[model samples]
Target: MVSREIRASVHWGVAHALPTVFLRRAAAQGDLQARLIRVGSRGTDEVFDLVEEIRARGPLYRSRIGYVATSHAAVRHLLTSDDFRTGLPTDQGPIGRVARWAAPTTLHPVEPPSLLVTEPPDHTRYRRLVTRVFTMRAVERLRARTGEIAADLLDRLETRASGPVDLVEAYCAQLPVTVIAEILGVPEAERARVLEFGSGAAPSLDLGLGYRRYRSVTRALAQFDDWLGGHLDRLRHDPGDHLLGQLVAVRDEGEGLSETELKATAGLVLAAGFETTVNLLGNGIALLRDHPDERARVVADPALWPNVVEETLRLDPPVLLTGRMAVRDTELAGQPVRAGSMVTAILGGANRDPEVFDDPVSFDVGRANARDHIAFSAGRHHCLGAQLARMEGEVGLRAVWDRFPDLRLETGARRRETRILRGFERLPATLRP
Candidate 1:
């Protein structure tokens, strides 16, 4: 599990980095909010402990400012239920004391809505536009290209092996960023610029980020928005098969997709596409190091690489928690929820529910029920990049094994400071000397 000390330099989720919500409203901010909300800051293991306690109480339990769903049954229900919506509650209501922080007056690049935030008619429309393009079929087409990218990155990584290497930074983090950049048709020269935005602008999604991080996020978003505007203009005149070109063509088609949606969606793809997959690779690699028995299995068969990926996802998901708001008065597991209520779905807890997964904490590569885990969340807002992420994980992990079959984690491996979506900032590894 990753730590919750994430700064702007490590991970940021664009629109999701921060929000005016029932849950995070009480969370500690960097002097951004006048009142502080106590969301029980804890390390990874402790957080999981709390999740177990909460789930044991019942499917739905009251949290700092809202309800937290712990059971897999409850979480799946809330996620798939039309009663719960994607958007957060804008009004502070009873929690206004901790919710009244004034963010930057400047226009944020992450706003004007993306698929990650909007609900109903808007989500329906925007989702339809990209559904066919982002489907498993579409993502599968990139498998060969992703493998090539993974191979090249692994080549550079292996050559740099003077001693122990930070696999997370060198290999895991680099592959997805490069792949997403190319897929977006970001010019080779401008790829770094996209990376700058993707890496720097993520804290905007975390309401708990201190004022320092918040201010940094504000600046990053402004810069990202400005550059993206120019990038879109260049693509408008000369479209390609890249996602940007496809979106630009959609804009020209005059059917749907607003400029705001285009910019937000693009930012979402860059930040989200890069960050979550980084953690997946990091966590998966770390798991292999800890579970050499499973490692040996994959090392022998190689055919079990996909199984390794699935089990890794089950044991240690990239995204630990997500939010959903009640669109109308409803009951979850017999707990009454008001029309405008919110729930923090403890995904980490759900994945480990004894009811769903036996010995859920144990990392088993051959676990038959591994795919049943909702590491990607479920229902309407399921991760759009799930298939693509799986492909990258398989390709990325296999490359590591192929290049360094004797690879093992170095002593000083470090998890990222992110609480919501767990990952690593520095995961050192070395082939046995």
Candidate 2:
């Protein structure tokens, strides 16, 4: 019998390493999609230039791995079509079987039972229960609390000694985590641990991770699963008035999530609750700082704050790309795609589709159609926390500038290395000019 670590290593090799090797060779051969996967932020110009190159190739271009969609219409069709489904590609043959068998049963965003991958009637059931508690009204109610949290976090930043501080860590990450923890009824004391686990596991969303990072991510997921199970068990006995407690109540009172489903749902909620928002906040601050003219416009009129958030999302989305597998033979944007083909949707590229918005690459905070970008995705799998994230972005960003209108973005900002999730890992800035 293979040990758990050995099994996980095999799974990583099959799932990640092989793909990395294929992509590297393809990238060297000038495969645009493969190149996009390997693109970094030495400067974002190269990323966008490659995206435009893919766009120039037409709506749906075939790459070494599979189909690549960069056009707004094509990407929207892929995301919203019933002929396609979400999740990783289904491996075939004996080695593929071993890879699947070796995978440990953990609550992963990409794994089955998690809303990211499940299809109806299970998907419908899980979504309905979660939506009931995580409604628009519920998010609106928390807007005030979110503002307060942002203000408090900025206040702490202001008190720190005058020097370059990593805003991503000190402010961007803290505000949303605090707000989400309050919503989930997670004790304040455990929020730091939650953030640590989230940071460790975040790279799981990216592709082609090295063995060291893969091992660390799997370990984080396993530990997070253990902690989540105990927390859910505690909630079972005393379901409080929080969103997670309500989910527990729903689970106990007849046709609802099983123990495994409950853990998966709750864990996704916890990790996703802040991860993207952290990216959004960081991206917004950087965008505003870089475009000082726009920052001045926002400062002159506070009502434009929400639009700032939308424009930031449009210009630099947290999740750079997502993919869907063809469920059956289908035609997308007049192109024939056979069954079992994978179509990668470059969300960032689609957001810059020249046909959608005039001067698509320009950072216009007042761009009327800024909200039309699918930064949160589309169709059934649209981000469940879209409203919450928008609120956090607006409030968190507004609080930062409101407290210190002359905040200076110092040199040495660094972007997160993950290809899929785009944001700053370190945004050096001084609170006062």
Model 2 off-target regions past 4 Å?
40-45, 92-95
> Pairing residues by index, what is the TM-score of model 1?
0.87
CA lDDT for candidate 2: 0.86
Query: What does the lDDT come to for candidate 1?
Result: 0.74
Q: Clashing pairs in model 2?
A: none
Q: Compose the digit string of candidate 2's lDDT tens values, residues 34-132.
A: 888888423355787888888898999899889989988999999999999986555557766877898877877778789888888898888887775
lDDT of 2 at 4: 87
**Tens digits of lDDT, candidate 1, 101-203:** 3333233432346777677688777777666756888888888998898888877876776688888767888888888888887887887676667567655
Where is the poorest 10-residue window by lDDT in model 1? 30-39
